[model samples]
Structure formats: C-alpha cells, structure tokens
Target: MKINANEIKVGMLIEYKDDLWEILKTQHVKPGKGGAFCQVEMKSINKNTKLNERFRSNDSIEKASIENIEFNYLYDDEINYYFINQKNFEQVEVKKDIIGEKGKLLKENLNVDLIFHEDKAIGIELPNQVQFKIKSTDVALKGQTVSSSYKPAILENDIKIQVPPFIESGDEILVDTRTIEYIKKV
Candidate 1:
C-alpha cells in the first residue's frame, strides 16, 4: 500500500529502494527557507544497515505488508529459541540474534507476536511490560527520604534495573520491557 511520507511512524515497515526498512525515528522539519520534509531514521531488515532519508510530504512510499502471528515462547537451548503457534500447534525455531536483547525478558509460556513478511519471520514483539522477581537489592536507608531515588537491583533474569528505594529482593514487580524501568509492584 502507498502511504504519504508524513504518515510514517516508528516501528513501521516500508519498502525503499527495493529493500525493506523499519522506521526507527522520524522528525518533521520545516526550515525557514525550504519546504517541509520528514527526516527518517530507518534500519534495513535484510542487510542490517542504518540509513537516514528525507522525504517530502507529497512523496508517497510503499508500505510493506506484514502479518502478526501469536506464538507462545517455549524454551531455548543456548543456540535456538522455540515457539509454538497458538492457532495451529506448529513449532518454529528462531535464532537468538533474532530475539535480540529482549530475549532475556522472555519466560516460559509467554505470549509474543512474531512479525512475518512473506511468511518469513522478520522480528518478534514482546509485551510492553513483564513481571519479574527481584533477585537482590540494597535495603532502603533510614534517613534517605530527603529525595526520591532509585536503587539498582538484579532481576531473576540477571538484568540490572533501577527501582524505587522501597523495592527489595523477592518482590515481584512489573517492568517496562522497552526501557527496562520499573512500572509498579505486582
């Protein structure tokens, strides 16, 4: 489908120069002397390369058709991660690199969306927030209430994140997967 340049948004997959690109960021610029244009930062899906391009508002771009399939994450064997399709019970193995850093947030039976382009898995999308148990953290100080401060803590996944001072080990809390920030106690 063709879309106006101004309609581009982060996370959208589009075709440019015969290659698929994922939009990472976009900025609409209207300089004092020139016509308005959109500055976009995109990553090549096939080549794994980054690019910056400018498109006028009147320019139309091809938006790639993508399909989202719900899959339940099963397990990983240090080499490949496995997922089972919820609708058909079919299983697929995906490389660790395809899951990226967010793979650490994945727990057994967690549901995620697998993005497909032409029946090939292009990427995986995790939930916005996930619940995790704090592994270890320092106790709140007796008189440290003067200012709001966050303390570093390790999660069950061994990922370090800053949480409110009152949070302690063994507490279950919701964390924003994208930013790795504490959302609230669960």
Candidate 2:
C-alpha cells in the first residue's frame, strides 16, 4: 500500500529502487524557506547497505507487503536460529546475521513475529517488553540522587542496559526489547 512520506516511521519496511528498505531513522523537518519534508535513513534488507534520502511531505511511497507469522523460539546452532509454530508444530530456520545482536534476547518459548518478504524470512520482532534479571551493576553512592541518574548494568542474557540507581544485582526488571532499555522493576 502507498503511504504519505509524513507517515513514515522508524523500523517500517518500504520498497524503493527495486529493493526492500528498512527505515532506520526518520525526521520530519519544516524549514523556514521550503516546504516540509521527511528525511529518512534506510538500510537495504538484502544487501545490508544504508542510504539517506528525503521525501516531500506530499509524496507517497510504496510500503512493502510482508507476511508476519507467529513462532515460538526453540533453539540455535552456530549459524541459524530455529523456531517452531505453536499451532502446527512446524519448524523454521533463520540465519544468524538476520537477527544479529538481538539473538541474545531470545529465551526458551518466547513468542516472536517473523517477517517474511516473498516467502523469505527477513527479520524477527520480539515482544515489546520482556523480563530479565540483572547480572551485575555498580553500587549507587550515598549522596547520589535518584531522580535522573541511570547506571550501567548487565542482564542475565549478558546484554548491557542502564538501570535506575536503586537497582542492583539479581533484581528482576522489565526491559523494552525495541530500545533495549529498562522499563520497570518486575
């Protein structure tokens, strides 16, 4: 389907120049002299390359039609991660590069949406919020205020995230998978 440039958002996949492009960043700017435009940074899903482009607010772009299938995480090997459909118990394998660092967030039986283009798995989307335990974090000093300070911490999955001053090792917290940021104590 076609969408106005102003409607573009980060993480949306759109077709342009014969390739599927994932929007990495988008900024709607209205300059003093010219009309408003959407500045977009895109990454090619197939070639793994990046591009920056601008679109007029009135312009329209073709949004890629993708298939989203619900799957439960099973396991992974050296190169691929495996998932199984809950309803049919069918299994599928997706490449490691497709998921990259996000693979660390995968745990047993976590339900995720697999994005397919032309019947090929291009990406996987994790749930918005997932629970994890803090593996380790620095001790907050006595004089430190709790209002705006955030401290670096590591999760049991070994992913680094920032947590509030009150958080400590072994604390369970909810994390936002999209931004990999701490949401709240569980």
Which candidate has the highest TM-score of all? Answer: 1
TM-scores, one per candidate: 0.90, 0.79
Candidate 2 lDDT, tens digit per residue, 94-158? 99999988899998889999999988999998999999999999999898988989999999989
Residue-level lDDT tens digits of model 1 in 149-184: 888999999999998888989999999988989999
Clash number by candidate, in order: 0, 0
Worst 10 residues of 1 by lDDT: 140-149
Alpha carbon deviation, residue 117, candidate 1 (Å): 0.9
Residue 140 displacement in candidate 2 (angstroms)? 3.3
Task: State model 1's lDDT.
Answer: 0.92
Identify the runs in model 2 with alpha carbons over 4 angstroms from their true place.
1-10, 25-40, 53-62
